[model samples]
Target: MSCEQVTTTYINAYYEDMEKLGVRRATLEPRATEHIADIVRLVDTLLTKGMAYRVDGDVYFQVDRYPAYGRLSKRNLDDLQAGARVDVDERKRHPMDFALWKGSRPGEPSWDSPWGPGRPGWHIECSAMAMRHLGETFDIHGGGMDLIFPHHENEIAQSCGATDKEFARYWVHNGFVQINHEKMSKSLGNFFTIREIFQQSEWPDTVTGEMMRYFLLSTHYRGPLDFSDQSLKEAKSALNGFYDLFERLNESDPSHGAADQLLQEATVRTRTAFVAAMEDDLNTPNALAALQTLRGEANKALEAGLSGEMRRMVRQEFRALGVVLGLLQTDTWRFKGQVPQRASGDAESTAKTLSDEEIAVKLAARLAAKKSKNYTLADQLRAELASHGITIEDRPDGTSRWKR
Candidate 1:
């Protein structure tokens, strides 16, 4: 495929993966290629402001023009210059000076610009895209910790130099993700895609998309997240607890009696704690702990017999708080069936024995048998499913639930 086609395919796959993990779609989506005009304008502005210089068809940002060049990365110009790698091209004003535009090479896509046919540099593309969509001074700029250096620093220098304003009010750089306590790299044989994680035969239990999402949020964003089977199992167990509580709430009647003051207070406290944790640098681990505390209090209240109104209020608060973390939003009944199950024998083999659609078909057949008063067929189907490591729970309303 062409470069543009490959890029589109990757972007589409990324959106699909995000959707699978229950992530909401972004409000605005902008592509660097689509904003070539904006990029060219920014580069031209940099050139006019004497912040960038053109060499042949290539335009490079002059780091010497921006005094606060290394402020974000917190390194002195002398230090950067000392550590800079020797480049064959000696046209740049400074060793640290980076490209704003690059002349097109053979068999490469090119855009028409005042400085001849070229494309925006890697760093300039993001700055131009952000300014185009979010204005010259946006609230936040986020990326991996690796980007904090040359990429983000260059962006700050070029953007602020051109616009004469702060590029962003806040810069949030998240830490890396490790696999099995080691750096996740293809060379290390530990690199895993989202699809690979869900479908990997190494794990004994199935990994659902939501389970992966939960495992990600269980750690603080600023800290390295160590991904392992144990970590995933912990995440699965935590989600099961929340879903179990949700199931209880669903079963309870919500139209009778007054609200319990104690439960109401607990819910309020949980909300406060959840907010406090999030406000403290997006501490997801603490926020999740707060939710767990609330879950415990909610369980105690449920056992102590809460009034219908109080139960309803508690359930509403749980869902409201969960919305902030993108958790606890799925229907309890529907989600419970999706939870992974572990049983005797080979897990991979057992998991493949029954697809969700196949289970649904069997459940329908069992229901049909029961309705027709053919108890023998229904019992036989139940036994057959149980042999495949599936558990079937028949409800009073003639509905069936299965988990595996």
Candidate 2:
């Protein structure tokens, strides 16, 4: 695939998980192919420092040259060989030394350098790209824990070994993903691609992007998320609860007095809980629960008809916390239609007879009011739209949209 295609796939997958568990966005996304210049530069510096060598067309890093090779992962060179594909290479000085640049095999992509023609080795790609984006040393570095060996460990060696500076200050590794009780295996015909899944559900293709994000984030990043029908259903239900509140709040006047106060208090608690959970290494499940609690408090206050600064406070808190969780983002709980979309064409036709446009229009109006700085009117419009299960956004770009 082209570099653009690979980056898009990575981004789509990342966003899908974020939406599901309510992560807003990342600081940056650096792709391997895009940082070829940096990789080549780093490779040259490594060679000049005697930490790397070019034999024929291939370049390899001298593992023994870095004395702290196993510091991060606590593995000896001998243990690495136990599971490594260590077929002898005549040009290689040692079996443990890995490729910095792989000499171009007939059809593969290659970039020219002092070391002949080849692409960067996979491990080096991350090291170079991450350093270029996050700097030689950054506060956090994260990836699946499965990458601890060879991949991340190698990154620490190559990046730090070349720059002679510290790499990531904190190393974060998310747990694994499995299907059912067994591991997800393609040979078992149980693998579900995002495309394949969206085709099966009534969920809009656009929303699938968010759904995948939320699903992944629903569980703590450091824990193994069990993928199954039950898990997805639970996620969907949680999503429904969140959107339901947003819809209701949109319909209720933004200046609904007491309700607004409740929203503000709930927002603080939600934010505090969420930050605490994430600070402890992105504990999403607890974060999710925190949102749910905030939701409950808001609902109680709204039902009791809260007013004044209290009502403003409640609304602000709900929106603030919801934004962090990536919930209450879109204007409507549109995924409800997604489930039924799986039905026959005739059923879809019948369902379509019930118009969503009316609600969408009202949500759009609420968004406009919010943008125009008419807080009370915006709240009133949101409340009106909520009765129809619509949600609204007065976005940073000064535009509004609705979904249901």
Candidate 3:
């Protein structure tokens, strides 16, 4: 596919996945760089400042002049030159000098530039787009950790050289994802695209975008992430637990017992710890640990017959933290079909969906048959439910619960 077609498909899938995961942005709508005038104007400013110059129809940035060029990545110019590929073009003033605009070849995309009919280089496009959407100085700049070397470094050098101001206040880099101890790549046969991951639905335990999002948060943002089937399964389980807790709390009656002081105290401590973790450079793993603590405390309290207020508090704690983490926002009943979860592999996909009224009638009929001492009739009703892939267990207190 062409670049425009590929980008449209990718960005649409990206926005849809983000929306399902409860992530939204004030901006990030579609944009284009078709206005060659703006790009030409930008090149004119850089050329006027003498930080950039044209040579043989190609424009290059003079890296030697930008003193703080390596401040972000902290590599000295000498060391960078030693580590970089040798540039055979002795015409360049320095080997580290990068392209700002490249003269168009036979059939490549071209735009009218002061130098000639050419195209903006990769680094220049990023700098231009950033300054266009956000001002010269913005709060944060983020990309993959691999981009720190040339892509982000060139962006900083160009943007700051033109505006003579800090480009972005904070620079955030996310770690790369490896597959089973190997770097994921198309040549390596391990690379998985956003569409590939989300489109997997044949297997009952297939990972969803929800699980993929959870797997991303399983480690720190700056830490190397390993993408494997096991990791996705674990992420699915972890995410499932949150929905499980939501369902449990929803089913329990909070009106029976008194206000649980112990549960309330746990909530405050957990929140405090969570806030501290976030302040400490967005330590998501530690913050998630704090949430697990609250989940544990809430489970223990509710299991011991805590009051409705206690359940409410527990639900509130989960809901509030979930909002911050962008998880568990969907309704619990709708998570794995319209019922509580069963201890099986992906019940939502395997089990038949049923309405609330149908479940109620089945439960009532089973109860009536059991009350009449008609074991055969009760067994038949139980077998009928099993046919629909629903599982039910009767309590000693004469109550029965069912889930699919």
Candidate 4:
């Protein structure tokens, strides 16, 4: 298949999966079809500086000319030459000379260039595209760890040679996702696409886009993540635990609990710990652990009759932390949309599920208790309804509404 046609087939599938998976993107920039001016401009500058040469319509970057060519990948020129693809173009003086532009071939897209009608070489594509959108220099450049050797190394050479400045402040390379014990690749028949993962029937419940993201986040970015039915199950279950805690506290009034000093101090400690973890090379594993620790501390306070205000304080703290890690963005009652049973009396009993008429009568009785200066009884009724999964909100017009 043609390269453009083959590329489009997967790009289409990519957007569809990302949309369904709730992945948000700010912009989409296609590098290949972006105007060729930037690519030609850099190549021209290199040629003027004697870093590039043309032969038989092909342009090659002289690796020996750039002293710091292998600095990014931490290798010497001789080491690269030992494994260079010298046979591809024997006309080049050095074995490690990489192509800057490839002469047009049959059945391939071509664009007018200084050397001849040709296409930008694969290595130059990123440098041209990034400089066009970002600048002569950018903050960070990242790709999979596999690209660290030649791809990223060549990009550094081209960018620096043209601009005479640092190409990127930071170079980030992430480890690959593995299937079983092996690296996921097509030749091994172990490759699995995003859609295939979503279709796996072994997921705990319904496979959601959020679940897929959660699975990816379960491992640290620097560590190799193993994908399997068992691992996915663990990720799904862990995410569900967060949702369960959110729903449990959603209806409870923050004003009801008493001893809150324990929760207040714990939340402060948790925040400090979370920030420290994030600053340490974006240690997501430790950051996620901090979130889980906060949850545990909050639940401990809940068990000890922690004040409702303190309870909400803890919830808000953890929720803010979650936002940083890109988790817990959904509604609290998302999974609880199923049939809810009434809970009442001491936060554990099967309380009476009230109908509309029953609700009106109970609200009226609770209002009477308040009028009679029975503050304790009024609060009790509110708590009773809350425990039953029914939330009573006091409206502005001195009316109460309940949702179950």
In model 2, where do residues sit more than 4 Å from their true spots? 1-37, 83-86, 106-108, 205-211, 247-267, 308-312, 334-341, 344-404
Best by lDDT: 1
Per-candidate TM vs. native? 0.84, 0.72, 0.82, 0.78
TM-score of 2: 0.72
Candidate 1 residue lDDT tens string, 1-404? 88878988998999877776777898988888899999999998998998999998999998889999889989988998778676637887778888889999877889999988888898998889899889999998899998999999999999999999999999989888998778889999998888666555223322366677788888888789988777877887888888778766777554343336677888888889899999998989899999999999888877667776677777788789888878877666353344344332455445545667788899999999999999999999999888776778787678887754
Q: What Cα-based lDDT does every candidate model obtain?
A: 0.81, 0.72, 0.76, 0.75
lDDT, candidate 4, 173-258, per-residue tens: 88889988789999999987877665543221233555666777767777788888777667767776676666555646545565
Off by over 4 Å in 1: 86-88, 201-207, 253-259, 333-403
Lowest lDDT block of 10, candidate 4? 333-342
lDDT by residue (270-372, candidate 3, tens digit) is 9999999988878988888888888788777776677776777778877787678776655652424324333334654456445567777988998998999
Sorted on TM-score, best first, the list reads 1, 3, 4, 2
Error of 3 at 208 (Å): 3.0
> What lDDT does candidate 4 reach at residue 266?
76
